[model samples]
Target: MNDVKAAVLYAKDDIRVEEMSVPSLEPHEILVKVKATGICGSDLPRVLGDAAHHYPLVLGHEFSGVVEKIGIGVSRVKVGDRVAGVPLKPCFKCHDCASGNFAQCKYYSFIGSRVNGSWAEYVAIPEINALPFDESISFEEAAFVEPSAVALHALQLIQFQGGEHVAILGGGNIGLLTLQWVKILGAREVTVFDIDDERLETARALGADHTINAKNANVDEDWKTITKGKGFAVVLETAGSDVTMRQSFDISANKAKVCFVGTPVRDLTFTPKQFEQLNRKEFTLTGSWMSYSAPFPGNEWELTLHFLKLGRLNFKALIDRTFPLDNINEAFDLYRKPGSVKGKIMMLND
Candidate 1:
């Protein structure tokens, strides 16, 4: 068995680079040489003792790679094909999957969460998890597909009408990516809120019509003024802050849709008045989790690729930093610091 170097999380704030055996491929699996992996905010809980799960696990889910070996019965891709994967593994036979709601499948599993993921030099994955990358897309840019898909999924849940206004409650990667998707879906205006002024500037560059620095300004007054006192048609909460979640109610128009795309910890509480307001105003409240099953109907991986191919997405602007695999601890440290920029920590195999 070949040995591969990986950053494994043993417990809270405990991660180390270690050598492990390369995973064996099943008949339906394919071996991939991971080229790039992006760190996510979700991984912070696992690192900070906030998330409830076992450790000594590989934790990267946003990744892109080249196909190295195809297990028996694999024909969709051959050796040396560039690809990106959707980490979700849904039970295709479930009723939810049959109805195009794979995210609701009873037995859903995801790579890098419940299973080993792409932090290693190589990963053995099922063919279904893999999506072909067009020749025009680079591995670095393709790494954005997973997060972009997630933002796209959130937009789908809201079912926003064309020319409607949207307010996104974060200027992080997901928030910025969602802004791009909202523009693609014909939203009349996209306003983004962030505590960091740098991130707010980044949001503006990424097509946001307006930006709010919550640290220095009042979010409610600013949002009301931006929407001309009617509030926005859609409010997306991606900051995962209890304060942001609470403020979501203040910025939503009557009959507006609110989508919670961020996963806040359990300690955050909501007031009964919020639900009552939702009921009285006929507000639609929904949550979007990870991506699931085939064709990914509403998401924008296809569209993101198109934007990338046409040089419209501007992924370079979003990439704040990159780190070698050996410096992963430094990367995580940077992530924990306040005022970190939007986009990802690219892990390169040296």
Candidate 2:
């Protein structure tokens, strides 16, 4: 086989386009020809050497592709099928996996993080990870299934009742998608807060009942005014900022449920007095790591496809730009800019 082109990251600010041997498949694996790969927040840490990662890594997990070949044991899909996958591989025998918590499994591996990912012409993944895409779903939209699943899992964690008011602490892709889920789940009001005016405007376009410019305005006071002093029934902290996490408590109503979905780069410190106040107020605090057990409607991929087919989810609006594989560095640079709200920068295969 001819060598395939891939964008590999070596260290901080070091990434290259090179030819690498396309992986030979194991009996339980499948080879996929990558079509569209989306840049994620997690990719930044890996590129900057801030996160623990294996060097010379192919750095993309959010992706959609076409099936190139199937390994011996694969019967679920055939060559030429359009697909997307959750890049997690778990040891099903582990205690966490046994209980249906795959993300918490002891021997969990994630693509782009622990293994070669989609920033290449081809990638080999386990047969179990790949899901067939519906005919109507574009590859670009399919790349969003992973983050959308994260949003869906966050909503599942909160379990908000119908008519409850919810507050989202970011207007990025995850926050915007969660806003749609909140509306689908019947929230009476959804308020989105962001520091960027353009993102705030996008939130309004996406059906947020209110949008607050956190940089210019006092977030807690703005939220308080919007809620008419009642506070919100649920608060989702997707901004991944220590300030936002702390502010979540200040704006939540008594007995409100708070869900933290974003991963912060730095360790956060909370005082005992804060817990005491939360306990006194009967607030329910929880963290949603990632999706684990929720089976897709027909299959996990089918649920994403169904949502897209029914016109319930709009990922097209979320994608702001596309770059060729050779220009991966420029894409990452765009991602690092302050006040950037452009969702899902993609690398297209030529």
Candidate 3:
């Protein structure tokens, strides 16, 4: 009920730790004592670039905590339950929401971006947004639910089937998570492409059959070698860069499924030949938005927790480092250095 330490972003490249009053609960909200929160790739633009929609906001979405208090009408979970926070708050009356496509709801409000969020000692969220998990999963691992659900949601978009050749066009956090999901879903062989050697190694350790350094290798020839010149049956572009976006087309097999899960910041153009790949091969091209489906946050969030408890998601390898709540600025500072962050950087409340 007193002031708590929270990281507030006043402007681009300006974030600081300050004492603020803990959020009060609404009739259906739950007060949570946040234990861990992860900095997402999308946060880079909001923190370092000019993507923030508002100034002086608390910006963290991927988080885990223990329920400290509950609203009068809340009954799904008790005060002592452990839970992962869901960021999407779609307007239930929207057309998309009525159709069970909550991610497409135009009037949706998101945590961290559109409102104050969990880069703090305490956060209050809707009771329905608190997805409880058992004690078998650690708090840090539970914090990964959002990103993991994102990866799964993208695959779910394509009705992803396994036992086929799959190529992931990035070895970053989302790419790494995507790689693991495909492997678990029964992909026969998986190849990860990236410029960083360390990330490639991590991908290999996480079940990638091959890791190609796009910077140093002849990517076109190397991918051909991996697939024996047949091309990938399924390709996921998670880098959001022009290079990888175009590569996703080139490496795809005829009539293959391709999904772009990354958000591109710049305008992308393809050449006549490059654009022809979609027409000639008849590739099924689609892009994935924020993770959500029927029944609110959907199976994506539920299955992520299920896998985490089963010890299959490998959250430990995806976390690069952890910092205390007071040093949240120091965590943002890492994003300024090129290629400095190899994985998720977490802020722990304790």
Candidate 4:
């Protein structure tokens, strides 16, 4: 492969579009020509702050591509297949991976973090990580499979049968995606809380029963009334702020399932009230990491494709904007603005 164009992160706040060498394949690998990728909220901190596990990285894993080449013995997908991929490549010798809990593998590596990733013309991934989709799905929608699957996996951790009141504590991408899943899973009522009125409105259009602007409203009193003082049967905290992380426990019901899906901006600890909710209400809190499971790639990816194909999940509506890879700096500035409800800024290959 010749040198390919990429957005490379040389250091914190130092990303530039440059040509880099394309990756070589291993026996189990496939070289994908990246078609589309989405700049994740996590990408901001990692590229602008200190979240990169390593520097000079090509920082994007939420991408869709077409297979250009394959390595020896690779038969999961062939050349020209349109695909979305899981970013993880876990060392199977680890006890956790051997037991089917791939997410907890002792020696796990990631595309954007541990290795170069999809912010380029091409990326090499394991055949298992490259999931093929039919022509019915667009690369834009396929690029979203990773994030959508993340939201789906978080819901998978809960035990909601259906017809339960669930409150999503953030209206970001994950929050909104989880909101759709809650409604699809048959929640009697799904309320979304966010400081962004625009995101709340978006959530409303996407099927949330109600929206609360935490910046202006009293979440405690309103949440009680919203749930008829029964509290929410399930709560998802995707905001990642210190206050919202604490609020996830505060508004939970007795025996409710609470999932923290956001990457915390600071240390998350259980304070008096949060601890009291844990003690008094008997809350079950599940911390969801990158989505994956036994046979690799996980159920989330499978179900996301099914829902996307059936029109149950709308990937296009969640996209607020798009940019060519060259304008990544401008995209980053726009995304960091106060109250910006940028769903997901799609980065396109020129």
Candidate 5:
């Protein structure tokens, strides 16, 4: 391939579609013809808030495509295989990685940040990063594998078991996906909290036992009634906002497992009262980073595809809108306006 069309980010709020040379593959690499890519919430700051590591980058990680070619030493997948892209590239030699905690590796490179990514017609990825899926799953659905894996990783971090009350403190894409995974994994009751009524409705449709609009309702009182004053056995903080992060601690039951899956943008502080909840309740507080484990990108990626094939993991409603690759700038524009988009915004290439 001589020429490739891509969405190039030149500076903050400055992304354009341009033709660039296709990337060359090295050993253990695969060239995927890009099909569908979801615009992650993290990407907003990279393009609009100047959170990108460098300029003129192709910012995409949640993506799926067909393998156009494979470099030598690539045996897991062949040309024409449908695959999802794993963004994390951890140094296997790091202590964290050697211990099966790839997400904790400090020595690592990331696609879309440290290197070029898949907002283009094609992208060259490591063999282990391209996870092949069955023909039944659409490229759009496969694009959700990264976020789905993220949601699963958080649950796995706490070793969540079924038959306990679970509280999801966000109703965004990741929060909704986490809710679905909670229900699929047999949580006794799943409650989703969000400021948006529409997203709360979506969560209800996705099998959330209860939906709380924290904006209007008294969350402290509502959650008390929902949990029958027992509090949630497991609380997942997915909004990354100051309010929800603190709320996670407040809504937890004694010795509850609380996992922070959302990334916060601003400085966070907790009052002496709020901070004491951890000590008093004996909460197992943990933060989940990128998804990965022993055998590379780990079972989270595979399990996502398995559930997708079984129709247990829903990906359709999570998609709010789809934009053509040529109109990616328009897609980013939607993000500039607050509350303009609800779910995942996908960019598709024909």
Candidate 6:
């Protein structure tokens, strides 16, 4: 195996770029020379102690690359194809996978989290996981497929029927992307809340009907005032904070469905009053994990790619910065900076 450079996480705030043996490919795998990879919100926690099964792990899953090598029997893609890949590896013979619910598969491994990921110059992935992109699409745009898949997948859980008034908590990238989906999917109006007004403006620019600065204003009062006490028909809790989670319960219309898309860093609590709101509203609460569903990796991945390829889901506005692999440490610092610019930050293979 050749030597490759990768960013490995040793522990909380302890990521280092060092030389490592290149990953070997299985008979059904293809080796990809990563061209671009984007940082993810979940990546932050794992890099800072919200770790997975192991440390000393290469930490990037949202990426696009050119095929470099192929193992024997890999026919799905050949060398030099530009592609984006799914990080979820499902054992296809499993009952869950057979039924097309890869997320429910008993035997599933997540790349970047369970194994090595794309922070390196090269990564070995299953042939099925590698998807060739249109020549018109840049690797930078392809790198966004993963996160955009996540945003779209959350909406699939509710299978939005349109004409619903929506409320999204958290004006992060996922939240912003979700707001666009709501408008496109037929929500009459969408109101987004974020602690940062700057981020809220980003959301509004992306087509949110209204944006709320939750930190400076009373979320309930503002929600009631704008909603005329009717509340939202669909509530998406993407902030993961106890405050946003509880507010999701408070501001939801009766019989509304609330999907919790954010992974909480700490235990969240709800007061008796909050519990009463749930009881009174009778909202359906659901948790949205990673964006894969069935037929192995799921429709979320396909849906994201289809829209991105068609240019319907324009994420160009989401990219704010790019850095080389060597400066990945600086990339993470900016990501963690308070009130950092609201857009995607990427690591180039160069």
**Per-model TM against the reference:** 0.93, 0.95, 0.99, 0.96, 0.98, 0.95
Model 3 C-alpha lDDT per residue in residues 224-299, reported as the tens digit of each score: 9899998999999998998899989899999999999999988999999999999999999999998899988899
> How close to the true structure is residue 112 of candidate 4, measured as C-alpha lDDT?
76
| Local accuracy by lDDT, each model | 0.81, 0.83, 0.93, 0.87, 0.92, 0.85
What TM-score does structure 2 among the candidates reach?
0.95
After superposition, the stretches of candidate 5 with alpha carbons farther than 4 Å from their true spots are none
Clashes of each: 0, 1, 0, 0, 0, 2
> After TM-score superposition, what is the CA distance of residue 343 in candidate 2 from its true location, in Å?
2.0
Quote the positional error of residue 220 for candidate 5 in Å.
2.1
Where model 1 places Cα greater than 4 Å from the true spot, the runs are: 50-52, 293-299
With a 3 Å backbone cut-off (N, CA, C), the pairs that clash in candidate 5 are none
Sorted on lDDT, best first, the list reads 3, 5, 4, 6, 2, 1
Best by lDDT: 3
* Superposition-based RMSD of candidate 4 using all C-alpha atoms, in angstroms: 1.4
- In model 2, the runs with Cα more than 4 Å from the true position are 271-275, 294-302
Over 1-350, each residue of candidate 2 has an lDDT whose tens digit, in order, gives: 79999998887778999999988999989999998999887777778655737787887888889999999989988999998867888888877787777778789888878899999999998888888876788889888988888887777767665589999998888899889888877999999988888877888888899998887757667787899998888999997888788878878899899999988877887788765758777889899887656342113345556787789988887888999998988887775676563677888996
> 88-203 in candidate 6: lDDT tens per residue?
88878887788877777788888898999999999999999987887888899889888777777888988877798899999887888888778778889999999887778788
TM-score of 1: 0.93
Better-scoring candidate (lDDT), 3 or 5: 3
lDDT for model 6: 0.85
Worst 10 residues of 2 by lDDT: 294-303
Off by over 4 Å in 3: none
Per-residue alpha-carbon lDDT of candidate 1 for residues 179-203, written as tens digits (9 for 90 to 100): 8888877999999988888888888
In angstroms, the error of model 6 at 223 is 1.4
Which lDDT tens digits does candidate 4 get at residues 63-181? 99899999999988999999997898899887898888888987889887789998888999999899899999998999999999888888887756668888899899989999988
Better of 4 and 5 by TM-score: 5
* TM-score of structure candidate 3: 0.99
**Candidate 4 residue-wise lDDT at 48:** 72
